[model samples]
Target: MSLGAKVAAGETRFTVRSPHAAAVDVCLFDGTAETRLPMTRDGNDWTLAVPGDLSGTHYGYRASGDWAPERGRWFDPAKLLVDPYAIELDRRFAYDPRLSEYGADTADLVPRAVVQGALPVVPPAPPRFARGGLIYELNVRAFTMLHPDIPAAQRGTVAALAHPSVIAHLQKLHVSAVELMPITAWIDERHLPPLGLTNAWGYNPVAPMALDPRLCPGGVAELRETVAALHAAGIGVLLDLVLNHTGESDVHGPVLSLRGLDNAAYAHEPNGALINDTGCGNTLNFGHPAVRALALETLRHFVRHCGVDGFRFDLAPVLARGPGFDPAAPFFAELAADPRLADRVLIAEPWDIGPGGYQLGQFPANWLEWNDRFRDDVRRFWRGDVGVGLLATRLAGSADLFGPDCRSVNFLAAHDGFTLADCVAYEHRHNHANGEDNRDGHGENFSWNHGCEGPSHDPRVNAARAEDLRAMLGTLFASTGTVMLTAGDEFGRTQHGNNNAYCQDNAAFWLDWAGRDTALEDHVAALSAARAARRAEFAQFPQGGEWLAPSGAAMTVADWEDPASDGFDYHVGGARHFRIRRAERSAAI
Candidate 1:
């Protein structure tokens, strides 16, 4: 059954799926007044149809059944539950202890699904993503938060991204796609408000289908319009999604939506303890048929209604965890078979903190994965490590890891870790402002501070840092797979050494366009133009292309094993490297 409130000719239908609930009713709210309509049940689905137009109605569900957390079945009728398939929300959800308590009726404290008319029918054009192109990853809010050209009212919002100034920056760099960090409806972690912080990354999603009001107040239509604007400018959009876990935290966490309606939707141990595979309290049970259906529907809604070009799944191993990580998981098969999504770009973070979690290069051939091996090897090479041969392999493409059939998404820095500037400025993470006494971020950053730990006024130290930064960016663009650059890295943005700045929704996370390193910016642009011409060269080569040495001779095992080698070059038959090469200077531009 199609879930959520759908309106048609003079009739409106409501449907919900919960296998364990004994009884269910749809709750309609108009200020302090409420109307409860009992729904007819057929197996796992509860549905009802009314004969009048119910287009802007605020609605939720109330299920009556047992409340036993020890056995993982908590169904409290008093707690109003938001529909999982809702396309619109009346407002953003605010946290309250009473909303999850056993006997309290908290109807007024939750967000309701709006009974929307029909979704627009603007089909997406053929995907703009090709074999090898640049991907610029950015947060919708932080990217333009400090831009002076955008209107004051539009700053830190989705509407600001569609501004001509923002699009022009992307066009100047020849960006093939803009991968926006998670924009789905999410909540701050339970401990952040008291610490005077909020979740800036939007990774902890509450509603997979609904966009966060703080990010996009104009709702789905606003996002659709933004997508259209980017498409007209010849740039594609990719959404980072959190499908591994919900904002409803641990056992002591709140029962906002999924936990309130059906605890069975989440993964559990044989003893009924919530499986914490995501390291984010609880994980979704992809083995369940209903849970799988919910994930599928969420993907389809974004494609059919939002017109997105692709998705990057956070903690992707959780989706394929059947006893352990399996490349042939049901979800992977479904994605390959779906005509609407097969051609669209699909990327995976490729690892989690669960058992057998580090399954890099193990995903199906159809999906592109984040190559952490590439990240580490590139960092070590520029940091003056001794393994030049290893760096050569990564630069050519991690053929040893992904095999010849699969492609990799090569990136040196992302949102979770330090920015590219911080990678060269701090040897260790500095996260004391997170209120955790600098104990929250990763311990091993694989960075080098050149001379000093933080900012240095010494000209020699600053000069050395700038050269290393150029070399890192140069190596990334000179590779063979798709490349992603953090939004502020082009101008050398820094988080002041805070590697895990997820909780800092302040200036530390926002991109400051006012002060930028213009020289580094130009060098990045030059590298991008060089990469654009190189991508067409690589694409012309057939699968299993011929490999050769820099002297245009055949490559050998010993040639690949030479540890003293600095760099090697190969041609894709007739394809050639551009003449605009990096110089051995502090200021390469």
Candidate 2:
């Protein structure tokens, strides 16, 4: 709130935070020409006032100081840095070797932060989404790029989500909330540009608050209008945010934004080596007050301006890590105390590549977690590698993992891995196209090929795969607690067994509406209706339920422990019954 360009009266004031810089300059751009204005230093902040209203002005920052990377002080005036508080940009970031060069001028390569005028803030209201409802996770660009009804000009943009056909499909699935993948401004990784590939997923973010111009040409207004449309259709929106690391990357990485302004914003060891808790080069230091402030401001900005319901944090453990993961971190306390974010739905991915990072079911009581245990255990159960006991535990909300309350967001597949269709059609990962020699993505997927690998022309193998998908969907719908279905999974979308398809921005990752399985989609709709009808029962674990065998006899411990046990009937107080049979590969709810 104290930083960034703000217009008051007839003059515009610009403020930035760079405690390590000896001096800072605000670079104002008029066409191709630039004029640098020196800012007054006061403690950790720099301020400058310009004459007249500069609301539509494009500007950047250049901090002058030592270029010592070993001591964590990287202040290079040659590399023009973006504002950490920028909500809009003149263009999207592009990868350039000059960005990391010490003396090479980067003014021509970096994106300029556009000074925005006042924005309309949505009135405070309770989130339209609730617990125990379905969350449909989707990639905005990929999800709409292949849709037939959306206009060609609107495809692959945030405005496409507001299309009537898209809303109709969401309404048909009874989606409680649509969890959109990152729409924030991001840059391609250093390696991708050389390899002729790009980071299709927007996980590698730079400006935390800025919207990517490529995905959102209309800026904040585009997002605000889309949110209003989804809300009007009774579907909430949740953004998947990446606050753990920036696209600036590691020691040899680019000198952009925070790294150029104050390298201390990143976590460093005693010897000044960057701490890579996120496996994404460098991790943000949550211990720093500035980092926490930026994060809080970002959350409030989205909630106030765009009217988003909540956020799903990617690599969430970094948010709670100061140097070590702590349950009582100040960030958590601050988020709870802030009135703006207290009521928003918080979901955590719950793990990272850091020390002691696997904190599943350890988040705050009010937060929901993506339960990988549910995903793996369900996959193993259908693959016949595990018995019904493990499946039953996941179905009953995994009380063993989260105690009595159910905060698990049960999901079989997500954007990062193989789709539900691929889970039954591939025994091994087929990611040779990723250019990593099949070394990327998870090795053990707990998948099966049903007597045929990849796509098959045999009708019997296709039938088996379809049956397995229906059974899994039935299990997810019948399970307790909130559930999530990745976009296009309801209609059998496939990434061709590419578990790590973050770079396949082409036809490989886009949803094929023309070739979608309509029968499977109809089955999902029916399952959603059934869950909605019994919403009360699915909200929590069923009480006084009897587990019976297929022959109408009570299930015993031996039956549950038997790996050959194919199916069982669950009767909840005789009001509702769920039948699952593996022999026929069918589930009746």
- The deviation in Å at residue 126 for candidate 2 is 0.4
For model 2, residues 1-589, the per-residue Cα lDDT tens digits are 3899998888899999999799999999998899999999988999999999899999999999998888888888898999999999999899999989999999999999999888899999899898899999999999999999999999999999999999999999999999999999999889888778999999999989999998899999999999999999999999999999999899988987999997888999898899999888999999999999999999999999999999999999999998899988899999999999999999999999999999999999889999999999988888788888888899889998998799999999999888999999998999988788999999999999988889999999998898999999998998889999999999899999999989889886799999999999999999998998888787787679999888889899999999999888889877445888877887778
Give Cα-based local distance difference scores for all models: 0.81, 0.92
Give TM per candidate.
0.94, 0.99
Give the per-residue lDDT digits (tens) of candidate 1, residues 426-530: 999999888899988888778999779999999999998888888888778867778889898999999999999898887756888988898888889998987
Which 10 successive residues of model 1 have the least lDDT summed?
580-589
Tell me the TM-score of model 1.
0.94
Q: Report the number of backbone clashes for model 1.
A: 0
Q: Pick the candidate with the highest lDDT.
A: 2
TM-score between candidate 2 and the true structure: 0.99
Go through the candidates in order and give the C-alpha RMSD of each one to the true structure.
Answer: 2.6, 1.0
